[model samples]
Target chain A: MKARLIIVVIVLALMMVVMLVPIPYLSKPRTHHITLDSQRYEYDPGRLEVHQGDTVIIDFTASDVVHGFYLEGYGIETRVEPGLTKRIEFVADKPGKFRFRCSVTCGSMHPFMIGELVVGPNTTLYRAAATMLIGIAGTLIYLWSFKGEQHE
Target chain B: MTKIDLLTAAPWLKPILRSRLFQPVLMLATLAFFVMVILTGLFGTPAGNRNFGIVFVWIVWWALLMIIMVPFMGRIWCTMCPIPAPGEWLQRRGIVKRTSGKLSTLRWRFPKRFRNMWLQNIGFLGVAIFSAIILTHPDVTAFVLLGFILTGIVLSILYENRVFCRYVCPVGGFIGLYSMMAPLEVRVKDPSVCVTHTPKDCIIGNEQGYGCPWMLYPGGMQRNTYCGMCMECVKTCTQNNIVINVRSIGSDLTVAKERRLDEAYKAFIMLGCAILYSAVLLGPWGWMKDWASMESVANWLIYAAGFLFINLVVLPGAFALTTGLTRRLSKQTLSTRELFTHYAYVLVPLGLAAWIAFSFGFALVNGSYALVVLSDPFGFGWDLFGTRDTAWQPVGTTLIPFLQTGILTAGLLFAINTAYKIAAQYSQTHRQAFIATLPVTGFMTMVTFILLGLYLG
Candidate 1:
């Protein structure tokens, strides 16, 4: 029984540590506004075009019921609520047309709630340098946090 | 031997094929093929993905369960389950090691008082509640793989027998319960063989290896409650007593003369979970989606707790309370607690039947993904069938979903019948009480169908 308890505690602790410790990373800021509802996603354009080395910031809200924003290839997901804005920022390192869709069940047109992101070549060297520095700093901070623990 | 003997012995003639080792190998091969299909469909050409869904439903889901899980070796799916492979690897590598061995020393002490199936009941409901998202989304396959790896890791570190299988696995509980209706079972050829043998190798592992990983003492096993049919016991027994035999359907449905309190509580919990799962999976309430997608940590926590309370605490509590009141009105001697505990075993079959119904629908929809690899097993289009250019349709076709619903309904009716039989076997007066509960069951089933329709529609 005691072994079970110890195991449970250890597992819980590991999960907590993994969840709480955010990795340090840097990327350029690029803002995007999107409105979603059961029927459709209202954005500046259906296609989000950005350069490779830029941070794509999606500031999104739902116009109707709640809709979940999911980018399949990147493993990024966030929920967009009506009248409430949610922010998601990620680095566009890969050059490709990545698809995004609404994960939450909305209505009859839920399956058609799809969007895409097009990444092109890096336009600014300064932005790339800054992002690299931030990424390095983030990595150092993450390592520092776990350094005190005994590594087996 | 007489013709009757030959007829009975016909099933035994295929002994080598039906052997425990053979079954596990067959199951593993089938799983491998299924995995390969899934990988191909996900990465294969558009043509491959389209036909994958069809083959998954017609072949893998129906054929595997009917031909393998149910008939060949009941609940054996839980034994060779690949879901926990990743988890086991992680645990074995000491990626997640325990700091204190405090819990290890006290592991042998089994708590005499606390064995309620509330956890099992709640676990099933939790899985069912998520079935909407899980079944429809293509990403669930990855999630399933991740879950298996995590479970494997946990089990590798734990010393207990089938700890992951018994308490943690949602599918295991479903199979263990529903398999009560499956005709195949591992049994002792002679009761005397079990009794006369000293230091029973069946229960305790011999030189060959470990004993029953599911931890069932074959002597006391009344039903398939915990048997994984790993057949470790069959091989261990020096007496060569254990025989895989066929029996009447629903043989395990008979109520025990005396029931333990925990076992009884488990029955009620199981019943409640079945109702809760049916409602969440098949009910039409859009609020459920909102509840699942709630962004606030506090709100999500509350929703989860509320769900647990409904399935684990409130439903069983209410049923047990009602049973107690009925006993009181009939001028019976049993207390409410005692009555609740005593009648708990009756719900096992009912719960299992509901699971089978739900699983059948899911399997039908997703099992076809297994055959998507026929044209391109290695993502290399051999074009063996030439019909590869067909556009893949999303699962949840009108006809397939409709058929699935009907199958689920049939399973629900079977469960209700099992519940009625169990009640009749237990208390004479309670037989009417059990029949009275049919309306409630019907209401829940209706709610489930509506929910499923909404999700599928």
Candidate 2:
């Protein structure tokens, strides 16, 4: 019983310590500028040009039902419900133009909920293409590993 | 035999469709596919926001289990379990290539003194902490399914028996703990037959196959803790000694002497989990968002610790303190542990009812997603069923939600009544005639109604 108690206490203490320990770098803030009632978004400057050290905040909202603001490559995602404003922040440490899209299952035209983030020096279009290529490669690899030998 | 009797008698009537191994593999593959789907649906396309299919699967299946299945069949979910199948397959593969006698025996004996209901309690905590995120998010559905698949495979290969199902599976733990209040049970027809039999086929499998995977001795089985209703024991018993019996609701609680410390501990854990699940899932907090946003390792660690604190520290601690307080008040020199073990039995029904109430709304709303399976089994289009295109609107206007809330309230009252009865029996006090059970019961009843309203409206 004593040993068990000691173990529990130690485990809890370690957890507390880890939880309190802060990450070294400040989280970069990415702005997702959006309009709620209008169901539209205007990324201030509609396109962003940022260096690797900078952060961007996507300050956004939805006009109708809840719309999720999600960027695939950088792993930044959050919900933008109607009548509510949401800001998703992320670092542009990686020099790449990532595609941002709405995640929430919206209406019929939800399939066209696509947007692009331009990163680096006037190479945003190039970065977007590269990111798309990487996504394609990742998909192919996953299919190769998981799919049955019949495909081979 | 009558229809009811025939159904009861042939409990193992259905042939195990997929090998225990297949379920886990399929679950893993399905989870992986869903993760990819979430990523693509969220990131790859413009109209990706409508993938409620995965979320529907996670919430509806579990809701069905808690509401209808666990109360009726007693942990049969652990039998057709998809989580541990991969691990068992790995174990089988390893064992097949080796000489049967050459391998070192791998059975580890559970220490008699150390055995406690901590695991069950911990399991409930685990489920409660994650319930908010798991119930709400479509993306996290993949993760939860993957978690089960990983757990199933890992435990099956490592342990001699289904340790994941018995000791670790959060859902299994909850079902086993609260299922004490359930009326139906599988038990031996004759104790004498069990006593006379030299080799217990129920515990150790005969030429037929592996016996009770949870290691329950059926002759002494009184409660729903260890039985997975695998029916291997039923099949192996030479005398045909086992039968599924229907009895009074709280029959298991009346037999106090047979209660184990682990079981008593599990009851408290189930209660704590019930409260915590209600707070996190139904309560208006940003708990769901935090759970999703937290890094995976950190999220899981927090959940594990929270589980330990609530199940192991808080609930048991409270129950023990209450028993101690009662003893002092009554001037009775009863052992605190003994008193606690007896009183804790009442909380089982409360936990069961709370689980039912909490899950009822989600099941009703999200169960419509199952139809999507017919249209797109392999993610291909097949509109012939017409079920695939249908989006679930709640069955009736406000009527269904109101009816559900009433049913939930009734269930909670039943739980409190069961608790009060046990308390009266143990304390031997004048049934405090005016002592209102209504305040707490009423609060929970209101909470259930409000949650249903929010979910539906």
Candidate 3:
């Protein structure tokens, strides 16, 4: 009985270890190739979504005047002049949405030049959207079910 | 200004707010800036970011108007607005004081049919259609401002007492609509006092001040929709009846008798514009931007048609359908038109919120440009404040999405609350009210999602 109890304790400890450990490398690493265009304070394919353990290869071009790609969270910023392509590769280690904005001063709308690099599963946006949907559902249910104020 | 009974909470504030010089003083200060805007637009650098006119008007003043003036001060900007200043002075034949003997004008009666916000709506739509040109081109911006002043003058000649601002002036229309949500209001301290007092000095000029320039009687006004906050009534009131009261936000939305189709359409147009502005200006669609920027005359025509259609048809149609569904499902018996008009108030808070969110995108990032522009108002290499060389720095870029999300969410909730309240006001029972709000709730959620997709996508 004591030996069985010891075996159970060891198994439980091992299970906790498995649960807590982050085996990101074990999951798999894949590379994603994306082409992005920056023009007049906007980006083509403004959203880039990838998994946590994927490599992201971005081929960027500025169709208009000089523009930029300043990726937050990864500290990779590039200045792409018009008619030139800049290639950038980075590991998708972070599983969240990070904005890639124009680093170079573009034009009047330059400051607004921004795009999104979303590493999946982008649970934050999903959760926010879910919460909004839930709010609607909850409001409907509350209104439909609850009896209103009695006029005095 | 009617229905007020409370005492002056801030007696010290009275003298400051009521002084005859106060509003004019404010106007002069802003007029100086306005002059600079015109000058910069005429002669400044061609670059919009570097130009004082674009930076100040679109980026700086717009930010203040959204975040501060409309939310806190109500028609305070109207009090100091430079658009109608030249026309008004020409009408009164003076800059500061009331001038006796029939005011200068052609004294033409403003057409009654055109008194509503319809003209303002058309004017705003006209401006918004060419927003890309007007927003970016300093020359265009100058011409637009000049056009407003010219219109104001022409109307002053044809009519009396700020007829342009009241019946026309697209900016005034927007301000008046949003002013309903402001916490501050200028109202009579007691309606009885105004009634008991003879001559109705507040409505007709006295030695102290001119009559209400916006053509509102201080004793009968209820909502903060039309009072331009000129404080002319305050100066003219011998009974000291006028008092600016600080109250809860959105108290004016509950004023049911004041609701109308014109205002409802204004709500739709504003909301549609906000949504479209977010999508076209901030969204990832380059072709859409191209269309708005007038890349081609055909594309612009298509864009303009689409713009007007979305605003006039798509949004209102969807809302009417929602209201209809709500009534059908809830088994409530009410006029469909009235319901449509009533529920339009739900969009007020949400519209402002959407605008605030949309403004946050460029305003935060481009706000820093104002510094450089100010030092060099004409961008003629004149750094007056020693900040013209201030580097272009986008402040708070990282937090923009979160801000947009939070604001949109708040706006959604506020809209839901407003819908429920309107329902309650219309219905006989709370249950019926809740049922009425259900469809509205769904509709509000959808609108919020559309905004979120534009901002967060």
- Give candidate 1 regions above 4 Å deviation: A1-152, B1-8, B11-24, B27-73, B83-144, B207-210, B257-287, B293-303, B342-346, B356-389, B392-457
Tell me the spans in candidate 2 whose CA falls farther than 4 Å from its real position: A1-152, B1-53, B89-105, B108-116, B131-140, B258-280, B283-325, B328-333, B373-388, B424-457
Pick by TM-score: 2 or 3, better one: 3
Over 4 Å off in model 3, which ranges? A1-29, A39-42, A72-76, A83-99, A103-114, A133-148, B1-7
Instruction: Give TM-scores of the second chain, every candidate.
Output: 0.68, 0.73, 0.96
Question: Highest lDDT among the candidates is held by which one?
Answer: 3
Tell me how far candidate 3 lies from the true structure as C-alpha RMSD in angstroms. 7.9
Please give the ranking of all candidate structures by DockQ, highest first, separated by commas. Answer: 3, 2, 1
TM-score of chain A of each: 0.53, 0.50, 0.65
Could you give candidate 1's per-residue lDDT for residues B88-164 as a string of tens digits? 32332321221221222213433433233445545666665554344334345335545644664565455445566
> In order, what DockQ does each candidate have?
0.01, 0.03, 0.23
DockQ preference between candidates 1 and 3, better one: 3
TM-score of 1: 0.56
Q: Per-residue lDDT tens digits of candidate 1, residues A1-152?
A: 45445544554455344423444445564654443232233233445777666777777777777877766457677886778888788887755445465666464324335555666532222222233233323322332333234321
Model 2, span B1-457: residue lDDT tens: 1113322556554233112333344456645555554553333322212344343345555676777777766666665555665565465454212212211225555454434456655655555566544444444545666667677666665566677677777667667765666666778877889999979977776654456767788888877666876666756677777776766665666666676676777766665665555444333333322442242658756765776687778767766776666556554345877767766665666566656765664444345545654454333455547766765332332233334444443454455454444444554333221121222233333443443333322
